[model samples]
Target: MFNEVRRRRAVQRVRPGDGRALKRFRWWQLPFRALFYLRLTRDDGRRTVCAVDVRHWRNNSSGNVKACLYVDGRQHARSGLPAAFPVPGGVVEVRMSAFGLKRCHYVTADGAEYQLVPDGDSAEGRRAHFDRRHPALSRGVGFLSSIVLVVAVFLLVVQLAEQLTRADGVSPYVGAFSSPVDLSAWGNSVVGLITLTASTERALRLRHSWLLDGAAG
Candidate 1:
């Protein structure tokens, strides 16, 4: 129910584009931009390619990290984060997270969802290539990232709870609590770095959980 409401709201944010041509992805933009493509062929021998272009690094400054929808290399529509662009078959949903894009899929009328393919030279594209050539290795890396994120979230929550009890008069009401897993100052910094890396890795695969990746974000 909540998800449906959110999706509807995202759809409401969509606006028609200005008919600008879709620019080519440049190598210098690799670290901040994400580009994906979906080629769909109609029964009439016509084809349209939908492209999702997101500029992630601009989110903090503008607070409007939008997804640009391009059809056949021409600007079609665009919207803020969590965009739902209407296409022929259905809607192409693009959602972002603090680390990177967490979702970019073509959702069909019958409720099926397909992830668009990332550009071959993009970060996501390289990750996809890795998954194809080394399935086991990919799975192993994903598993490790999940484990690291879980551990980081656990420690963060425990430490936060313990500190909250330290406020004046708060300890008397809630009783002082000590974190079972305590880390030194440097250790905490290291954990933060690891959590960021783990979240980024998961982002590449569009894998995210509110509890795990949410904390990192």
Candidate 2:
């Protein structure tokens, strides 16, 4: 129910594009830019390509980002992050996270969902290519990332609980608790780096969980 309301609001935020041509993805823009495409055939049997473009490094101080919708290389419509751009058979939903894009799916009227293809030169594209070319290796890497995030989250929870229990008035009500594992500053930094890499790996695949990625972000 809440999801539908949020979708409706995002739809309302959509604005017509300025009709500028979509530029090719440049290599230097690899870190900041993201582009994804969806191809669909209309009722008239004509096929059209839709693209979603985002520049991660170009957001406001509030971290409010925007997503642009391009049709056959022409700008069509655009909206803020968490946008839903109306298309022929469905809406193209685009969402972002601190690490990168977490969702960019074409949702059909009948409720089916399809993810858009990332631009070939982009980081996400490279990650996806690796998955197709080396499925076993990719799975192993993905599994490793998941495990890293799980351990990170567990440590975070335990530490947070310990902090809460040691707080001024809190320990009186809730008995003091100590974390099973304590890390030095250097160890914490290494854990942080590992978790960041894991989250980025998941983001490349558009895999995000509010509990995992959200807390990490």
Candidate 3:
């Protein structure tokens, strides 16, 4: 079975207005183009706020596209451009207004447009939505994993060098004893060569395994 996975935050909108009216608007008219919409209304009964909207799409790579905002049918001031939209990504904070009477509109990248209405107690909804959707990671697991792998390889090389040193063969003293220092030097050289070859092989094997795993994944 094919599963449909929604991209988080592909598009977002915010509408602040009167509390009671915003609730009615959400139930009746908020656009379904949003994966979800959040509304916020202030406690003082005077301010309303909407949170960003998350959109679902396939290709979001288009760099920051200029968007024109309209307030109650009149062109509003253009704000700073938003972050680049990514493929399969969502948008946020599409619109905002105060009190139940004000409305806002946004014209997005592909010429798709959205309308927002402000209602009471909507600002809280907006804050909640932002908090829930904000991307946060617990830790840098990939970086830590790479660091551990490097350390392991270094230790393995050291262990292999020790084994190679012990594997070196020395000639036995038969008729006359050779200089002990010379015998020791010869043994050390043999061990060094063995260690070099072993280390090279080990490194190649590690790299090969990494590539194989990556391909499989």
Candidate 4:
């Protein structure tokens, strides 16, 4: 996310001109709990839209609210709006200033980021491609599963080690009591080993040619 306070300062209008500009300036100065909309245009003919709909107050609240529209390494146009722009669907189209080169860059608003690419002949196709490549739900689930697995393995190992140490001082008999305890210990040890092994396998798989080859197939 780009810095919101800096964005507002960068885009703040010295004197209001367009309706969009006025709305954006008013929106940027709003209190934190209020909802706002921001539409940023670039120097080149590229537009990226975003909205700020948050309810948290902070010192320099404007810094918490960011809106950026970039072209190449430079920021062409940007805005910082307070949280109260009532645009339908909370979407605003960024417009570019006249006479500039179209280049690749990114835009960020209210923690939401967007890339501004050349509007090709197949605009719909390009958008679909981007959507397919960035499936938020799938990525989130995978991240969460990795975290859970790591935590579960750590807890399992701690519990298993504690139980095994206590059991080691007990009888050497191979009867029913001994058998269940041994089996329990074996089961826990196997689980712990498997968890550690799986983690190692995953790490290796990340850079493994075999995984890539299988995927290519």
Candidate 5:
């Protein structure tokens, strides 16, 4: 029931797009750009390719973050973040987190869903390649990312709880609290960097937890 309502609201967010071909990710655009592709076959046998392009770095300059969908090689639709484009076979959903894209998948009418493949030259593509070529190593990295997120979230919760106990007016009733492994301000910054790295690595595989990732963000 909840999922259905979310989808209905998401579809309403879609906006029309001027037809434009999906651009290849450039070397200089790595930090600012993300592009992903999906291909579906129609009943008559023709093929349609869908691409979701987002320029987060550019968004900083424009003051708007948006994701565009390309059909075949031309832009078909666009919307602000968390877009859902109606495409053949299913809807292509796009969503972002503070770090980067947390979801970009094609969900079919029959309920099957698949994450689109990234371009070969992109960071996501490179990570996918590593997964295929070295399954063990990829699993190890994934496990490590989970571990890092767990530690980050634990510390974050502790810090927040301790801070709450010391709030201006509530301390007299609840009493002040202190975190067990409290780090100096600089030490906390180091943990923030590691958390960012872990979240980015998980984003490569579209792995996200609302509690963990959302809190970290």
Candidate 6:
């Protein structure tokens, strides 16, 4: 019920876009821009191209960001973050996270889902390319990221537990406890930085976990 309401509000944010050509991704926009593409052939034997473009830094100015949908290179429709744009036989869903995009998929009427391909010049595209070029190394890096996030989450839980046990109201019920992996302020800072990098790396692959990326974000 709650999810249905949120979906309706998100649909309400959709607005028709004035036909404008989509711009090519540039090197300077690497940190702020993300672009993805989908190609489909109709029953009539006609090919169509769909693109999803987002500019992350704009949220800093307006506190709200939007996703733009393009068809065959021209703007088709747009909506605020978490957009759902209707296309030929499916809806293109775009979602953002604090670090970058968490989702960009095409869902067909029959429930089939597919991730759109990132623009070749974008960071996500480069990451995908690396995965293809160096499958073994890529898997190793991905595994390392998961390990880092898991350790970070565990430490976080331990610290929270210790803190809760120290509270006066809770101390009597659950005696004072200390974290086994104690770290100084500087050490904590380093861990925070490492976890942030791990989260960003995972984001590039559109991999997110509520307990991991959520806490990092």
TM-score for each prediction?
0.91, 0.95, 0.19, 0.20, 0.90, 0.94
- Which residue runs of candidate 1 sit more than 4 Å off their true CA positions? 43-45, 58-62
Error of 3 at 80 (Å): 54
lDDT of 2: 0.91
Which structure among the candidates has the greatest lDDT? 2
Ranking by lDDT, best first?
Answer: 2, 1, 6, 5, 4, 3
Model 3, residue 127: what's the lDDT?
A: 29
| TM-score, prediction 5 | 0.90
lDDT of each: 0.89, 0.91, 0.30, 0.34, 0.85, 0.88
Compose the digit string of candidate 4's lDDT tens values, residues 74-132: 23333443211222222233321111111112343444433333222222223334446
Q: How accurate is candidate 5 locally (lDDT)?
A: 0.85
Stretches off by above 4 angstroms in model 3 are 1-139, 170-217
In model 6, the worst 10-residue window by lDDT is 57-66
Global local distance difference test of model 4: 0.34
How many Å off is the CA of 69 in candidate 6? 0.5
Window of ten residues with lowest summed lDDT in model 3: 94-103
Residue 86 lDDT (model 6): 81
Q: What does candidate 6's lDDT look like per residue over 83-107, in tens digits?
A: 8888888678888877789999887
lDDT of 2 by residue, 1-217 (tens): 7877888898998989999999999999988999999999999999999999998866534467988999999999978888999999989999999899999999998889999999999999999999999999999999998899889999999989998999889999989999999998899999999999999999999999898888887
Q: TM-score order of candidates, best first?
A: 2, 6, 1, 5, 4, 3
How many clashing residue pairs appear in each of the predictions shown? 0, 0, 42, 10, 1, 0
Which 10 successive residues of model 4 have the least lDDT summed? 95-104
Off by over 4 Å in 6: 1-8, 60-62
Native RMSD of candidate 5 (Å) = 2.2
lDDT string, candidate 3, 1-217, tens digits = 1111221232232222222221122532322212122233334554333332322121223532223333222232222223112211122233211111112333343545343432332443342344346524212322333444454445445554454555435222223322223325565556444444333322211222332222211
lDDT of 6 at 24: 95
